[model samples]
Target: MNLLRERLTTPGDPGALRAEEGERPQSHARAYQSLKMQVHQLLLSRIDLEAMENLSDDHLREELGLMVERLLAEENLVVNASERRNLVRDIQHEMLGLGPLEPLLADASVSDILVNGPQQVYVERRGRLERTDVSFVDDDHLMKIIDKIVSRVGRRVDESCPMADARLPDGSRVNVIIPPLALDGPVMSIRRFAAVPLTMANLIDFHTLTAEMAEVLSALARAEVNLLISGGTGSGKTTLLNILSGYIDHAERIVTIEDAAELQLQQPHVVRLETRPPNIEGRGEITQRALVRNALRMRPDRIILGEVRGAEALDMLQAMNTGHEGSMTTIHANSPRDALSRLENMLAMGGMNLPTKVARHQISSAIGVIIQANRLTDGRRKITSIQEITGMEGDVITLQEIFSFRQTGVAEDGRVQGYFQASGVRPRFQERLRSRGIHVADHLFDPGRRME
Candidate 1:
């Protein structure tokens, strides 16, 4: 222990240490990682786990900070105050949180964290991907962090499993794939949500949608119109779904089904159900389809599915058609028409064997609106199209455009230039909204009105 401490804290030229800027040299970084691991192991050896279980998170962090500072002082470490603080923080994170990910998770501006392997980490900030300097000591260190994350959520990943879907306590969605499947070492992606959920006003501020579109969507939610949000990955489908859910009646009983619970619905009377993966023995597996079927019996006024990806689509569609109006779910598709085709494919996956026409008819009847979200070439997420499912037209499901964002060109700065405009076709559901006393203005559907 003494030898390791001496090696880690050996004083270099005082001027050289003080002048260090930007990233540390490779040798210094390796030495720092070694020092952190030694301190982390020593701290684990000294702390009483049972006693720690009694401490609140804030208290535990404070106590750990003091202990780490004491250890550094005893070693006579020759690091600057900034380095000292970072070392203490890194040690604390190793003990109580996702080690190298703690800083990224704490950052409010980061929307996504992508870990390719031990040495490369990337983050999405403001819809742009940027590489980060954060990394793990090695593959083993990365695996430990992955284990900590999955174990907290009662999920597991290993050579046998090789994959897992989990979430942070803060509701950030986490996906993990390891070894045989990942090609590289364990790869994990975290889709982060805001500490405070984004509201419709926030979306409008971000130029994601217009105020008129927001009004129409709010009315759709209140009027119990089943909605399908279509988008590619990271195009803000879940965020928009959450904002729409805010418009749901507080008195109504809402049930949400998800593979992993990521929806932040703010209703007093709500039930959230998450699917369970098969255990090591390949028994006791619960799927979203089973949960959707079970949610039907709960007498929910509305059913909000996190995403429809498999056999669960049949049950979700049935729930919407029967009585659970205002139910919403998302799908991965580039356009509204493609979304319908995907829905049809998913219905087939359910093994109902309904003919093509019959399946199309079922979808046309159940879905009231399809809101297409897209991450444009310039990396801005916007609601590109909103189409109303206008029933069948001779074995085909017909759709009418209600509103859309037309991209004209990319600006010199590489920002996407677009205008959100109403398609001039007032929706058939406008009548339903009116019947429920939620009136949308006539001007909201006027084609002449364009918002940039």
Candidate 2:
């Protein structure tokens, strides 16, 4: 142990690691294993693990310092002054943070973190993105960080497998690419999750949704009105859909299908299923379409698809049109009209040769309401339009907007000032509600109503 401490603390024979013949560096696996085992045994021999548990914080830390010192000296790991400082840093990395960027990523206010390479790191704070000086020593360090992240999720990343998508324990999404695959270097992108998933009330407080809109949407959800929430990427469509699904009766069975399982519904009768990516051997791939088909057989009263982006849109539409009238799904689009068009396009991806008119008819009958959420230039997510599909007129599907947000202008503070106004187009679904003995507010279309 003393010899190891001396060797580690002393100046290493700088040339000892170099081979005589100019060949590849020999593996240090055997030496490293021996060093680790000797240090661990020395630590156990001197410190009573059970006794330390009764010590207070300060006392425990004091005892730990003594234990570490003994472990370091007895192992004979003589680290020179320069190496000693680095050893301290390595210990800090394991005990405290992921170098300097861990604290920044852990900050609740930080929305996104980007690592262009080993040295360049950027973060998105508030609505503005800024570059940070946080960096790693090199690609080796960066790859270690990537391994640390993926290892926690039972994922693997290495030379043979250069790319992986994983989530942290807190559900923060992580994507990593290494070596030749990443052109630049090891790259990582993390999208942090909300500490506590937001509810409808929380969205109202955040100004993401007006109270009146929340009330109407909640009522619509409870009334079993099949809804399609549309938005661009990061426009909070799934978040809003999650809160809307929260309105379903707790007694009814709910089945949710997701690609990555981001929804956090709290109902007791909810069943959540996530799609699986293909294994390295090109087997065991379970897609969202498969999950949607499986959910249909689960005897679910309501089926919720996290997003309809591919051929799965056909199954989602069929589910809603057949018997699951209370089902909900999301699509990527800029507006309600575009959402229907996007649905038609995705339905085409299913390889069905249905006529365009028949496709529109199927969509018009399947989707009852379209709530288009827009991320304004100011980074505020607002329900820009609420349109009801009033069936087809001849060969064209008729869409009537009941409520819309018209921007007056940008405020002095750069925030957008918009008013939720009624389009004066009476909801065609009003008669359907009346037929079902469901009464809606008479003044729902009145422009005088304050959405607040």
Candidate 3:
């Protein structure tokens, strides 16, 4: 299609086999742009992107590559065999993969891929974001990429549905917001995870937690003590939840609920529930709270919510107390106390007009541990505080810090130096763990040596 539009248009320097238009660097770019736009338009008019996706990868690549070569030959474009193959792969990625953003997705270190507009792309690697040359040819090109993602997952995004949440093939979380709602042309953000989920040992290596803290959490999970992990946005809450949930007994049945199911729990007896958005007709919506209610009937030994947002907190707390112990959930908050506060607020959001005392009592009785995670300036995520919920004292829910990460000073290498030390206060549930046959070393709770 593009071959028809671009003429040989005055050849480049002698002996330059590349069909690129410009004699200088800038001219070569113009030629590439002209060539790419032609390919994009040609493929759209001749083939259905969705239909072609059904083909096997090898078949698709072979078929698409030949068509690109055929189109280029017709355009009288002159490129060596190597450039032709590269062009075909790029076109194939644009058609089958994420187009211009494909390379960024392939890079393991890139934790996030942010696109402000068609011409601007940024990626976060090693905790810092920097601009990259990757970009869409135009806004329409970007929308094509977004639509390709949403439609596959049975979602839609347009003027009518301008914003959407979707995940890529590799389980990378994706968000798409179009014009009118987006303000920019089309905004897309992708949050990628480690190819292999991090383990407690892995986190210990990263200094996210000490070996002793990890052991205590393992005992808490084994003891069936309900835990609520809290942190701000991008503070490693879900990652921590995934790591901690790994400690659940394999024989136990675990039910996990999420808006976009992202947990990769390895247990054999696990049932996963994902919330659904309202359909195009504004019907068939399933919410997290509804799922929590249904999970109780399914006989889940533990209910793990990806994140507790909104009215679901009430049901989750109720579920945790009603014979379903050791359940875990994540929430957005700054500290252990704030996590409780947010859970309370979410309980109110459920339209349960119970008194504050009643809600506090429910939280205090249901939750046994609060793990607060934080992302330091150097981009390391560490458990800042781990508090044990003793019970309600008056109208307040009493909590004692079991362990905390303290920043002694900055390191010479520019990395923030810190150590996770146990708090002298022993957890009230230590005896409970003992009853459940889960034990912790006594030295781990020595206040003078542990807390310091």
The candidate scoring highest on lDDT is 1
Residue 317 in candidate 3 has what lDDT? 90
Which residue pairs does candidate 1 place in steric collision?
none
Candidate with the larger TM-score of 1 and 2: 1
The list of candidate 3 runs beyond 4 A from truth reads: 1-30, 43-55, 80-83, 411-414, 447-452
Q: Rank by TM-score, descending?
A: 1, 3, 2
TM-score of each: 0.93, 0.78, 0.90
> How do the residues 173-230 of candidate 1 rate in per-residue lDDT, one tens digit apiece?
9999999998989899999989999999999999999999999999999999999999
Error of 2 at 178 (Å): 4.2
Error of model 1, residue 309, in angstroms: 0.8
Off-target runs (Cα >4 Å) in candidate 1 are: 1-26, 75-78
Model 3 Cα lDDT, one tens digit per residue, 1-452 = 22123333223434213444344345555566656766656655656556565778778877788778876765567777777877888898986688888888889989999999898999988777899988777898899899898887778888877888888877778889999987879999998978899899998887788888888988898788999999988888988898888999999999999887778898999999988888888899899999999999998999999999899999999988889999999999999999888888998999999899999999999999999999888888889999999998899999999899888887787688766777788678889988988778888976565332
Instruction: Report the C-alpha lDDT of model 2 over 1-452, residue by residue, as the tens digit.
Output: 12122233222443122223344235543343333334444444445556656667565544554555655664455646654444444334433346556667668988778898987899877656799867666787688778888777566787777878787666677888888888989999887777888788888787776776676787778878899999997788888898899888899999998766677788999898877766667678788999999998999999999889999989998999889978999899988888888888988999898999999999998989999988888877788888888899988889888888888888888988877877776677777666765677767777776563
Clashes of 1: 0
- Lowest lDDT block of 10, candidate 3: 1-10
